[model samples]
Structures are given as C-alpha cells and as structure tokens.
Target: AEAEAIVRYIKDNPSDNIGVITPFVKQKEYIKKELESNGINNVDCGTVHAFQGDEKDVILFSLALSEHTRPETYAWLKNNRELINVSTSRARQQLYLFTDSNALERLHDPSQEDDLYDLACYVRSAGTYQLTPKPVESRALGIRPYSTATEEAFLENLTHALDNAFSDGSHYTVHKEVPVSQVFMENISSKDYFYRGRFDFVVYRRYQKKEIPVLAVELDGMEHLSDHIVKARDEQKEAICREHGFELIRVDNTYARRYHYIKEILTQYFRS
Candidate 1:
C-alpha cells in the first residue's frame, strides 16, 4: 500500500524526479508509467545489477526482508552483499527505506539481531532524514529518433562505400534488419581478442574461390566521442574479434555521413 501510494504521488508530480528500488523486477513498468504520465522526466527503477558505479543525491531502498528469506537465502545474501552495499551508499543525503514491519524487525542490533541482520547495519544515516519526497536525479539519455527513410538512406550510403573499398572481387552482404547475436561470443574461448568493439554497421565480406570467412566492416557514428562506455566496450569487442581471424574496418560515421570518405575507407580496407 505504501509503495503504491508513493508511486502515485511521484506520478502526479512530474517536476519531482523519482528513484524506486525494488527487490523484484516486476515493478519497473508500473513505476515507469506513473512517472511518465506526470511529465517527471528521468525515472529509473534499479535492480542489483544496474546499481553498480552509479549514485544519486537521494535513494529509495525497498528492502523487503521476505525477499531475502527465500530458499537459497544464504547464497543470495553472500553474493549480493556488494549490490546491497552499493545501493545503500548511493544516497549522498536523503534515504528512504520502504519496508514492512516484519522486514524492520529482521535487523539484528547488538541489542537486536536476526538471520539476515548484518545487511541493514551498512546503511548510512543522513542527518535527521525523513519521508519527505525529493526530486530524482536526471540521468536520461537524449537520443534523436531518426525516420525510416533517414535510416534507409544512411545504410545505402554506408554500403556503397564498403562495396567500393574491397574490390578483391568480394561481395558485401548487409545484415541491416537483423538483431546482433550475443551468443556469438560463446564460440570463442581464451586468448586476448584485439580490435575489439561495437560497430554501427557490420558488413560481411565474401571472397570468391577462397576459404576465408566473412569480414566485418563497422560504421562508427559521430556520437562515439560522447558515449565513452560504448566506445570502451567496443574496443574490448574488437579485441575479441581479432582472435577468430575476422577482419574489422572501423569507418567513422562522419565519413559514412559523406559518400566520398566512406567509399575511401571501404576501398582502402577491401582493396588491401
């Protein structure tokens, strides 16, 4: 009842940013809609995984102890201590713990303790904190949506350059509308993969009369400079790709935005 009330309050007040911490992932969509309807931008419901290396001025931790007392409770408690620690430490000042009486009673003090007691001791005391509603942190990504025509044109221009680059009688196969496979990484085991990273456009190259596998031509968008995490992850991906004898050509999006430069990178990569 309290959780629902808080969700309703945050939704009605859009000017106030809201953070919801729930033990279960089921509440995300419900909370997201409440915030969106009120025009309160930047609402995030964090699970244990999403809380890493992230912090805010205020934190609403929903520590439902019944959640922690399930079967395999000991393993969940041990492996998840860091997650709880990180989630609790996120608040610089205000901290609101939405929990039931049963959960509150589970905290074992020197004067009182329980099976899942030590976890509650880690929470920091914000000087005289209360249940006052606070604004949420704005960590929203500003992405401009492109129309279908724009995307089609972008891919058309991108492929043209790729075709021009690899004149080794190689065919360029574009997998534009397909989803990237996360399971593809499972095939690789051990050894440092180099030229690692994500590419905007992955062009597969097929060479005639040769047993060489397809090469991947990646298109790098201009936003690469602003999104450092993606860039770093891409670097790691590229390194991994190198282990499998795959060819990777990183064509800058700025270059792809233009036909001549895109063609130049493609021709240079494939022609080599």
Candidate 2:
C-alpha cells in the first residue's frame, strides 16, 4: 500500500523532484522493484543512508515497521538521533511518512515508553519543530547475561575445539561479539558502517606478538530462516566479511551435534 501511494504521489506531482527513502535495505529493494515493475524507474528510491547528502522537492519515507516487530530490536533507531534527522529532513517541500499509527502510538503507552514513541509522534506532527522529551533517570537493576541455550552450547563447543586445534604458542584467541568495523577499514559511509553489525565469534592468531584476525563465525538459529531482517543482516555481514578478505563461517544451531564438521572447517582454515 505504501509503495502504491508513493508511486501515485510521484505521478500526481510530476514537476516535483521526489525521492523514496526506507530504513531497511530489503524494503528499499522491494520499493525500487515495485516502481520499476510499474514503469516508474526514473524516481530515486533508496535506503535512508543512501540519501544522506541529497534532497528532493518531495520525499516519501517509509518506516517499514509492523505491530509484530519487537521494540527492543529497533532500539537503535531511537538512540541514533542523526539517523532519524536524516530520514525526516530529506524533503524540501513536502514529506510523507508511511507507518502503522496504532502500532507506533502503542510504543509510548505509559508501560512501554519506547523512543520510537517519540519518533512516531514527531513523524505525526509533519515535521513541525517539537522539543524532544528529556530522558528519565533510570538505574540498572543488574547485569544478567543474555545468551540462548543453543548459542551458549555452540560457544562452549567451538571454544574447546579451537583450543585443541591451535598450538600453545600460536595463541589462537576466540573473541565473541566483535564489531565488524573494528576488523576492517573501508571507504564506505558512516551510516553503512553503523549497521555492519557484530560477528558472533572471531578467531585471531597472535604470531610474533602481532595479532591477525583470520576468521569470523555466525551462529544461525531458526529465526534467521523465518525473519527477513535477521536474514538480511546475516547476508550483509557475510558480504562485508568477504569484501575485507575474511572468511565467515555460518553454523546453524541444528548442526550443534556435528562438532567434528565445524572442527574440520576450522582446521582447514587454520592450516591454510
């Protein structure tokens, strides 16, 4: 529906320079494909990051958020004010935001108090200047470790396998949740780097006191198959790792029993 509305808006005002921006790469691709299918390929359509320095007479922004989306999954959207600013300020004359109003409003319902609520309200105001709410003082209850049973098991097994495979002086260190940007220096924009994401585990070898990152690993679960966002993120991570000359080993949770298979791959990588 939002894609059709954007197409209609562009057609209705042919004189206005229009652009379509979406937060998700998948949605951006879908929107572009939809426009192209309808013989409307001239208009610019891309992710918000893709239009950072560009502006148009009119811009259509799609949130691509649904009611089923977990608020915590998109917490980054609220934390990064610059991202929101870029998405909303791309239109010189008019900006149309497509979202689920009910779902957005629910994010602010006293019990939730999510930053997306502020975002939803700001978008609802049609770019009207509004002071952002002051963050409430909060205290951390405790630092509880967060890891799925499968992930924990995989980490334990992989750690043991790596320890056994590598020599004592070689110093094969296994680090978890290593940021991708730290491993590679690229000419890509900051916005793209921001979402490059983290590797579940990174294997580094210290030879003659110089540490070298040799491999990255991702533990995939059922969610990766069912959730398009997770799948897209995984693909992006794999692409970036490959581009930087790092091999990414993706192991499914179902393969947890096949420790030898993972060990063999690691052995081959280390030996080569």
Candidate 3:
C-alpha cells in the first residue's frame, strides 16, 4: 500500500526520482518488492551506513530526533548527523525532511543551524551551476575553426580522453533520444578499444580495459533541453553516464538528416 502511494506520487510528479535510505537491508528489500509490485521505477532503499557518496534531489530522513536523549545515546545520534550531512549534500535544489516535532526539537541545535546555514549558503552561492546556452553566431565563410593540424589535435585530445575513460571495462552510459539498445554494436573487437554493452556504447581504447565512455546524441525535431522533463531526463541520463565513463555528444537532428555529422563525430572518435 505504501509502495503504491509512492508510485502514484512519482507518476503524478514525474520530475522526482525516488530514493529511500534506512538502517536495515531487510527493510530495503521489503520496500523494493513492494515498490516493484506496485510498478514503481528506480526506488532504492538501504542501510544509512551503507549510503555514502550517493545522493537524491529530495530525501526523507526518517530518524527520530527524540531518540537521542542520553549522552550514551550520542553514538546512535552520530549516525543521524552523518546521514543528514551526506543527504543534504546530495540535493542540488531541494530537500524534504520528515520526523516528529519532538524529534525535530531534540535534533535542533543552534550550532547545527550555523553549520547548515553555512552549507546552504555555499550551495546557493554555486550560482546556478547550469551550463550557459550556446549562442548562435554566424562565422564568415572560409574562416574555419578547424585547421588540419588543430583539427587533428582536437580529435586526438577527444580520442585520448575517451580512450582513458574507456580503459575500465565496466562503465555507465547515457544516450539522449537514441534508444539504449541501439547505442552499441555487437562486433566490437579487442583491438577496437570499444565494446558494446547491454544498454549503451562503451569506449575501451584509452587504458587497459577498465572504462566505458558515455555517449549522447540528440534526436528531437528541435532541442529538447527547453522542456523540464527532457532537461531532467537529460540530467539523469548524464549522471548515469558519468557513473560509468561516457561523455555526451549532442548533435542537431539535421546533422544526421543532411550529410552525417553524427557519423563524422564517430569517425573522429576512432581517429582520435
């Protein structure tokens, strides 16, 4: 029933990604099954101690503040502080905290507020942390941005980066608009320095065979970044891609429709 409610919340607000963290693995499994049975997608829960270096945009910290009443209870309270610090750091925009009022009062400390205030100030000071839109500028004909030498250098630089990233055999990938299944080819060779994964393309030319670079190619009638869901999806995809080693490459739809800028980029990837 709770899982159904969570799924309904997600479906109604598609912008949100659900993340659940608790102090028990059994609970995680229970919730996972409940969520799956109810058709909830991407719901994860695990022990608070197990959650580190991971984050969600919105987090529901369920630890009761009132539980830490005794000085000896401070040890248990320490976990809550750690979870709060880690959880708050994970959100890029917002955070949702739930607990009893008694617990909130118990957890409230003037010094803690100062620390949180400092962190919040730092977050706000990040100044959007969003990429500025590429402006449309017309260049004069024959004034090419790519000289043979510079182009080769640029290609080499990109190739080297991709190669280095793909040195790891296992990596994440993000494909924009392009179906996940179509991202990789089956005939990838050991010498090819790239491998096709179950979902996306893997770049393996860099190191030994450790990495797989993420790839993204835009395929909308127009740029889809303007849409919030599209943008969020793109962000989520990019995040997943980064978790592996893939980089995103955006191409105008016309690039493929006309000559083949997409192919050109791929060729350049190989050459680089």
Evaluate model 3: give its TM-score.
0.32
Q: Model 1 compared with the native: what TM-score? A: 0.37
What tens-digit string does per-residue lDDT give for candidate 1 at 112-229? 2221233333233322222112111111110211223334555887767656565467576665532223214444655333223234446655567533235555544322333445
Error of 2 at 140 (Å): 22
Q: Against the true structure, what is every candidate's RMSD?
A: 14.0, 16.8, 17.7
| Best by the TM-score measure | 2
lDDT of 3 by residue, 169-271 (tens): 6333232224433444432223222232222223333345544434554333122433343454456555555544556555432222223344467557545
Q: Decide which is better by lDDT, 1 or 2.
A: 2
Give lDDT: candidate 2, residue 256: 46
Give the candidate number with the greatest lDDT: 2
Relative to the unseen true structure, what is the C-alpha lDDT of residue 261 in candidate 3, on a scale of 0 to 100? Answer: 41
Q: What value of lDDT does candidate 2 attain over all alpha carbons?
A: 0.65
Kindly give the number of clashing pairs for every candidate: 22, 0, 17
Task: Report lDDT per candidate.
Answer: 0.48, 0.65, 0.41
**Candidate 1, superposed: residue stretches over 4 Å from native:** 1-150, 162-169, 177-186, 190-199, 206-213
